[model samples]
Target chain A: MNDMVKLEKVVKVYGHGATEVQALRGVDLALEAGEFTVVMGPSGSGKTTLLNIIGSLDRPTRGRVLIDGEDTTRLSASSLSRLRLTRIGFVFQAYNLIPVLTAYENAEYVLMLQGRRPDERREKIMGLLRTVGLEGMENRFPRELSGGQQQRVAIARAIASEPELVLADEPTANLDSGTAASLLDLMAQLNEEKGATFLFSTHDPQVMRRARRTIVLHDGEIAADRHGPAGDE
Target chain B: MIVRLAWRSLWRYRRRTSITVSAIAVGTALAVFFVTMADGMYKKLIDEAVRMGAGYVTVEHPDYSRDLSIGLVVTGISSVIDEARRIPGVTGIKVLIQGQAVISTAGGSAGVGIFGIDPETERTVSPLADRIVDGRYLEGADERGVIVGASLAERLKLRPGKKLVLTTNDANGELVNEMLRVTGIFRMGMEEADGFLVQVPLDTARRIFGIGPDAATRVGLVLASPRDQSRVLEDLRRRLAGTEAAVLPWQAVMPDLAGFMAVDKGFNYVFQMIIMVIIGFTILNTILMSVLERTREFATLMAIGTSPLRLRLQVAVESLFLGATGTVLGLLLGGALSWYFQVHGIDFSGIYSDDTTIVGYAIDPLIKNHVTAGAFLLVGAFVLALTLVIGLYPSWRAARISLPDVLRSR
Candidate 1:
């Protein structure tokens, strides 16, 4: 499989002088297309920093990131935004659906930004909503939905454009264990059905257990990389 | 989708948006109403000044304007009048011989400004003909008959048919005297006009002053509309290029009135600009707060693949929507108020006396509104443009928000 995301000796530092803190240190990673991977770490281990650098939402202080064979570190901010729009999708821990938009609109937002036709956006969003078990709840706003349902809508939004790389930062952090399990089941089903790659950062053990490949981050560096029994590469 | 998002986001803070919109609406309404009313009042003052003395456009000896000398008179008067009458905007014309003269009754004598006018033509243009409080207006055949202001006749202790002697110099600088009967009395509502002005028949003045029938000090051209003054002045100047006639507009003849209106209009515009700035600040505060409170949401949008430029565009669109809505509402309200006042004027009789004058032209106590379509559109466009300008800082701030910091904090 082709590599969907590649990070080469990445380092990210916040502030300077006495206030300086390193978020990531010389981390090298590759995520292949169609893989369900999780990067597990405690808070301050730079899980979100890695996700951000890989998503093109933030630039690394050192080294380079490649998404879909394009050098993101060399791209301008506008160009990086275009790369993210076309090649990447993100699911946040808080299920950051636009509150003013309905569930269907939230799912359709990326497609609209891609300048797709209305008919195509509607078809894709409706199918994704059904697949995520949010079919009847399409017209409801994020505030009206429960946390599990909002997270389902967020998952639908992430994969709506069929992006090559999907990044989820602690997707199940805010959900109960049962809801988290079902959400992981939904993500796995989508990964298998749609062949879309996903990289997750989480402290949830269930996510780590379900992950086909798990990379453990400790103190701003990778401690170990493992493949669980469920699916191994 | 951007517009939809902008519109929905505006309603997210319904109370704030409503308050901002209301402030803009009220400011715009007051601006429109006061601007139209002032336009009407100034129009009334200009018309009163021009029609009563020099017409909207005047023709006289080029040197007569500086000296006001009876010796410097416009010759070939019939041809000048005929040529002026052919001009497009020239609605009427009047020939007059104007000079200062001493009028003596049996009891006393006083100096006054005397005008020798074609009584027939003056009836159509001058309000003096219609303001005869007592007695009748002069006739073309009454060569010795004259119209005197009520205040002048009262001061002289005279009545209609009473004889008085006018003493002045003829065109040759020779002292001359003519006896005139008071044919009419007029109350012009201005102290300057009612106390110091007198009009006599044109032939009688020519005979008394020893001037030829073709000689006159001034020929005034009345126009159908005030806007036609400049074009008519230009045409008359071109037509009478070599006649040594100074074709002047009313503003040239009435500098005090012109200056007063200029200062008055300047103050009005400054006042209106202050109102717009206040409205602009209200819009700025609301939009700035909205952007500030939604920092996390904007960062989320950027992280999810929406460009910073697009986020800024959405915020601008929101401001534009707010401005357009308020401007439209204000125009409706202002138009209704203006229309009502245009038809039924606002009475200022309680506020101002009837004889209140701006540079000696009486102001009518009732003021109407006169808003042209162009003026209305200009005000609306100005407000909309100002709103857009005031929105720029907040949009820039929105685009400059740090995505990583905001998302990490959330």
Candidate 2:
């Protein structure tokens, strides 16, 4: 499998001096393309930080991060922004869609930023919304939609551009169990049927069970990395 | 897309946007309205001052303005007036012998300023022509006819048909006197003019004062517009370069009035600036609040690969939109108000008596508005630029938002 993201000895420290807390302590991780992976840990275990670094949303304090074979550490801020624009996508736990834009517009934002033709953007966004079971709710604004529907739009946005990697940080944390399970299944189906890679950080066992590969983090360190059927663990 | 986003974002808080726009519009309208009214008042003052005293552009002996000497005279007054009349902007020309004299009757005597004017031309240029309250104005053939102010006539206990004697020195420094009949009485509502001024027929002064028929103390040129004063002055000076004539603008002739107008205009500009700055701060507060409330949304945009510059541009565009809308609306409302006032003046007679004057120039109590394109452009540009400048801080704050921190917190 092609390597989608690789990190070596990445460290993230918060605060300064006596108030310092190490969120990620010299941890190493790699994600291959088309891999349905989950980074599972309790609070403050650096799961979100790892996703941030892998998504190029945050720079590592002491280690190198590679996205699609390009060293993100050496890239300038603008260069990193361009890399993130064309190569990576993110889904936050809060379903961070621009409130002013409709669901379809929110989903089409990345493609628009990529300068795609409008018709192509319309086509892709329509198909993605349908695949995420939000086909008829394209015109609804974020405030007009429920939490599950908003998350669905966010997922469609994340994969709309066919990014090399999708980093979702507890995307289903705010949803009920049924909704969360449906979202996880949709993401898994996207991963398998469309050959899209997804890396998520969640404490939800549903996500871990749905994921093809699960890496367990404890206290800013990887305590275990496991693969195969989730039931085997 | 940026424009669409900015426009939508502005209307998201419709009440806030409306409030800010209203503040700017009202401030700008007040500035425009008051400025136009003040300008109209100034034009009236300058017009009355120049026409009642020296013309808009004057040609006199080089030292006459400084010394006010009867001996100082434009020797070739006829040619000076002729040449001035030929100038493109010179609409009317008059040759006058101006001097200090004393008027006396059996009851009293008072020091006065005498103006010898051609009655035919004075009718077109002087406000006094329209202000005769008694009898008739002087005629070119009535060399013995004189016009006395209402206050002066009262002090001298005279009537329209009364006789008075004007005593002054001739050009040769010999005592000369003339018997003058009060053909008219004029009330200018200004004490200085109404109490101390007398006008006589040009021939009578020339014959009595021993001035040559073709020579006079000053040659005054009336212009079609005040803006033509300088050009006509310059052209007159250039045409009469070798003569002892000094062509001067009315501002130079009446420094006190000029100085008053200058200081008044300065204060007006400062007041306008204060109004604009206050409006600018209102815009700043509204935009800053919008930015603060959308911290997480801005962070999301940044995370979605919008450049910091783009985010700043969006904010700046919002400010521009707000400023443009307000300025346009202000111009329309202010223009309408000014046009109405221009046609129907604001009556200030209750606040000010007809005797009110500024720098010895009589003031009209009914004030109108005068709108100039320059004034409109200046106020509009100032407001728009001020809003843009104030937008900088909020746009900077928008661009500088820390994505990771905001996302983590929100």
Candidate 3:
């Protein structure tokens, strides 16, 4: 059987012959179980594009992508969407919490999508709110909360379905440094204790410093791969 | 959860939702009012027609139906009457003879349609005997009196005590004239049926026309229920099939009346459709604006496991809820309007609606209103269906939202 995640010589290209932009060129990578990894790059470095392919929101152009030994490239779009719902989660830079929903409801939305019962949902949501240190603010809306609280709510929402993988695309880009640091610490704690594999994209050195491993992408290819507890490169 | 969210969402945008719901409600109320008004006017016309001696169904000789004359009486009249009475909804049966005759006055003379009826039997068939104004109706076997329309009396300059001569061809095709006294001045407001319309005793009419006592030009029937008129007509046909007589309803006997009523009904229907379309577009506008404002919210749900079909169903349910509420409120509003008109009447005496009776029916601007229950249900259903039809497209668009694009935008 294959490992937890595998990308063997994957390529993603845009445009035709003359105007081709190779977003990913012959990339090969593997993530073992319970890994906290960050893909870092400069502008136009294809980090977001790479994250999208692994998150099942986009397709690889010329190679196979697999998760837990199953080929993701062979799955239909609908099935891929189902896989994302059941086995993966996502957080975005804009704190993409639905503005219409309260924080408790926003967190419960994922559990409802997963078809969890009400009592089970109550326990999970309350536990998650306390875990993210936003216990009393569960009833607050996204607009009513501070930036750090909203990110915490987003984190609660991301892990609500208990997925095997979480792909966060520049999650702390809009937050202040203090809020961003706290958010990263919460995510790292979850990763270390719960064995949930996280793959995030960012260019921030603070985020990179906290990551267990950071893969740097330059011009659509891996420039430097670093692995340690904290900045052992 | 979806329903709760949808309902709560409406509350979040209170002004927008209220405006939308008010638009729907006003649309529904307007539709209900017009639909019931048309139906009430039509019912009044039919009720007056039935009350003024013409029953729901009329059986006549196939030959004289084209051009009626007392000289043309069908044989086997007794058997036809017996068979017609056996029909399930038949309340009463009456025989009548009609013909064009010249009534001579001291000054001049003019042609008029003379109606011959059996007075005793006619009392069971029509309530017109109760609406006598000036003098008594044709009462006894010795009575030779005839009732005349008020307009006809005015034109001829004749009074209840005046003497007039009515002349027509006999049933054997010979000319025979009768001298009679103007017994009563009966008035029904109908221009054609009453202005030049006259009614006489059947026995006197038969003797003058040289026709037999047992024959009649037509047999008018009253069905117990107006809605069961066709059923009674069918029964009359089956019973009279062996004889040479043709079974006829009022529609068959009076083609001109049927045609006029059909045109009026068509006009009413067109008006109804126009009103419904207006209501439909109002709902469409409101729902379209609602979906447009919630584009991002809808996209977030789609990004979760809520399928497009589920989202569409959610929208449809919301529409149904709104439509149902509107329909109920509208029905009540319409009922109130109909009742107001039914009691007080619409005073159109100001403009063109003043004193206008279309085609011998009393359709003055202040017409009597009579709303039936069938019309109430149909109008309610119409408004509800219109809301659904108009709401479908906008809801479908709401369901087709793409989350990736929505998330990518600023």
Q: What is the TM-score of chain A alone in each candidate?
A: 0.92, 0.93, 0.90
Write down the worst ten-residue block by lDDT for model 2 chain B. Answer: B401-410
Q: Which portions of model 1 show Cα errors greater than 4 Å?
A: A16-18, A174-195, A229-233, B75-89, B210-215, B241-243
Interface RMSD of 3: 2.4
Better of 1 and 2 by TM-score: 1
For residues A178-222, write the lDDT of model 2, one tens digit per residue.
877766777777787877789888877777777789888989899
Candidate 3 lDDT score at position A197: 88
C-alpha DockQ of every model: 0.66, 0.61, 0.37
The CA lDDT at B320 in model 1 is 98
Per-residue lDDT for B1-410 in model 1, tens only? 99999999999889999999899889888888988899889988888778888899988888887899888888998898888888888888988889889999995888999888888888988888999998899999998898888888999987788999999988888898989999889988898999899999888888867779988988888889898998999998998998878899988888889899999999999999999999999999999999999888888888778898999999999999999989999988888898899999999999999888888888989998887786689789999999999999999898788777888875
lDDT tens string, model 1, A1-233?
78888889999999999999899999998888899998987899999999989988789999989986788999987788888888888998878889889999999998999999999999999988887778789999999999888988888888888787789998887777876787778778778988889899987778877888888898889988877622353
Error of 1 at B32 (Å): 0.7
Best by DockQ: 1
Instruction: Give lDDT: candidate 1, residue A29.
Output: 88
Q: Write the per-residue lDDT of candidate 2 for residues B164-200, one digit (tens) a residue.
A: 9989988788988888889999999999999999999
* Each prediction's whole-model lDDT (CA): 0.88, 0.87, 0.75
